[model samples]
Target: MTGPAQNALYAALFGDPQTEALFSAQAELAAMARVEAALAVAQSQLGVIPADAGPAIAAACTALPIDPQDLTQATAQNGVPVPGLIAAIRDRMGRTPHAAHLHWGATSQDIMDSALALRIGPILALWEGRLHAILTRLAGLAADHADLPMAARTYGQAATPTGFGAVVAGWGWPLLDQVQAMPALRDRVLRVSLSGAAGTLSAMGPQGPAVRQAMARALDLGDPERSWHSDRSGPGHLADWIAGLAAALGKLAEDLLLMTQSGIGTVVIAGGGASSTMPQKRNPVGPSAMVALARHAMGLAATFRAAGLHRQQRDGAAWFTEWLTLPPLCIAGGALLRTADDVLERLTPDAGAMARDLQIGQGTIHAEALTFALTEHTALDRATAAARVADLCAQALREGRDLTELARGAWPGPDWPALIRARSLGQAPQEARAFDRAVRAASGGLDQGGS
Candidate 1:
């Protein structure tokens, strides 16, 4: 029978050739090959093997095609490193002296950890690009809609008037913070772990340091002070970063879902999904999917964190758990990024609806500002002016007249209307645009492929 179907995310990550290229299984395999070559060279240089064999072993490794099935079977039997790989290389050399130096002075963890670093390098690059694209789209939206006022809700109740740009800025600020934090995360994820068995390069002696430096350079990973066979810092830090990103995406998705509600109608989605059963339904499918994927990614990160509590010197449970957890986290992150981009792209702002909603609570949003304006001209105190404005607002709502007209009739001050309007919004749009410009400049001109 066919095995249970792989997760749809797996199909996205590993089945689709274009997106699958981001993960680069070949790059991971090549990293392992380089580690093996580095180990042989280090061994030869340290007098553990004949110096003449180093170049030949490196050449043989470069020429060999690794059998993936053999590697899988070996991983199932032992924890890692199919003995078949070394055996296959030895057979190719046919009792030659260079064949004897295949994987000298290194253990399986060296290859596996370097492979993880190689995998993370490409993934982080993709993340930085995707996140910048999404943030730029958000910034553009905020700039375009900066002055369009809408009702702000807290605890599901209408509170005050706020611009759509303010809402977008709320999401943008956190995203900017997350983007700033990514470089450190990238460094942590791209660290090379090349210490031989038992967290020491005892097998390669004095040449170990040089070999590790060379391997890191070849693989484009950072060199660590020592091997972290059981330290578990890299994966744990990666999990934390992934979780934080997912949380931010989830917040944005939640806001989109709320803003698209039928009652709100401040924003409309283009090309939303329609129900197969009900032709009248236009569903917010993209935002819904983002919320689901964010939840999944956060849960996977929790699993990774739990796996970090494994016992010393490589716990099989923790290591194997990652085989199931890490890939899904990567896929979910990719999906979230793609969905955020699409959602921001297709969102249509309803300036008319926002204006209508600002007028919904019977001019309550203008109450305090009107009160302060009235306080300056009248004999009344602040509280009395507030009460008088509240009474006038209630009377205007019942009598079906404009609150501003009523205020003008009741107030004798010549500047009352202008003062109230001026305080309605004070420099909010300018501040948002400044913040957006800073984010764009910091993100290197909104280009996805920039540094």
Candidate 2:
């Protein structure tokens, strides 16, 4: 799973290597050990476990001198790794009373859950940085292309004129919202889990709440008011948020695929895929990877919903199912975010091709503009005037004369220059700049300040 040829995804295109390593077997074990150490210290502070035992146990977890192969074998036998991990740490400590106090009050779920939260906090921060980069790049694109005209389409046919910057803003806002939401999402999802045996921390006595709170402080995680042994809301929301983000990126990828097509060519991507046999084909490879990853996330979101159906307090079946679902979701999300940022950096909109697309309708593209201009002289309302001008433009296309020529013949007062030039960019430039301002606000104006 680590190498390119073996797993391909974690090493190749679909997973970020840094984030991938964060969820690796060694990382997971180490994190679990950290959680165990924190629990020991927290128990010692509350007088639930001996003070001398806490230092030795914490040191063992910190050093992680236990062998990986032994832990793996024990995990297979015990159905979870913490029992084996604890045995190894205790054996390494080598004393009856000192080793006896190791992991006195915590359960396997507590270690695993808290360890996952520890890993996730860092992962979410990684995404926040990546998302900030995206917002910065997108804002620049919006501002630079605020006036760049492109033919707008409805139902895959030319509808009117619009600026590409405005379209980019639509993409920017969803990502902005996601970025804005990260802090709260992390707070909610990265809570420390310290419930023992069952939902209640019965083994830790009445100081259970304080010990849990102390552990939360030790790990820099949110201290839940109650143990979330059965409550899957936090993890579910994180998955949903990531899935929504991937879905938004998928929308962008869909447009990128369409705009980069052979005939359309409204977009130019720097690094595209090559066809094996067809030397002329340069495929939209990045967006294609994005589409595949997004689809994977969307599909996993459904499985997560089913996985969250915990059968009462602590369904080992349901919890194990999450083990199968969430890590891949994280991998896909991390990879997609990176790919999207790269795609944005490498993408170039073909201003010339966009202008040419406007001409494909052969002046019929300006019918809406013409129709509005005709409203001044004629007694016709907008709909009637639009239909009247549309007819002339359609007939002109068939007869090979210009729309302006036909419009002047029929309506007499239409302003040819103003009407034919792309119109109704109404508020588009302002909207683009507004998105830039929002980015500045999020970054505390540092990203584009004094520029």
Alpha-carbon local distance difference test for all models? 0.75, 0.83
lDDT agreement of model 2 with the native: 0.83
Candidate 2 per-residue lDDT, tens place, 283-366, comes to: 998899899889998898778878888877788888888887888888889888999999999998899999898777666777
Superposed on all Cα atoms, the candidates' RMSDs to the truth, in angstroms, are: 3.5, 2.7
Once model 1 is optimally superposed onto the true structure by TM-score, how far is the C-alpha of residue 390 displaced, in angstroms? 6.4
What is the number of backbone collisions in each predicted candidate, taken in the order shown? 0, 0
Clashing pairs in 2: none
Candidate 1 structure quality by residue, lDDT tens digits, 189-283? 78777787777789777778888876677667798868788778788888888788889989988988987877777889899888889987788
lDDT value for model 1:
0.75
Which has the greatest TM-score? 2
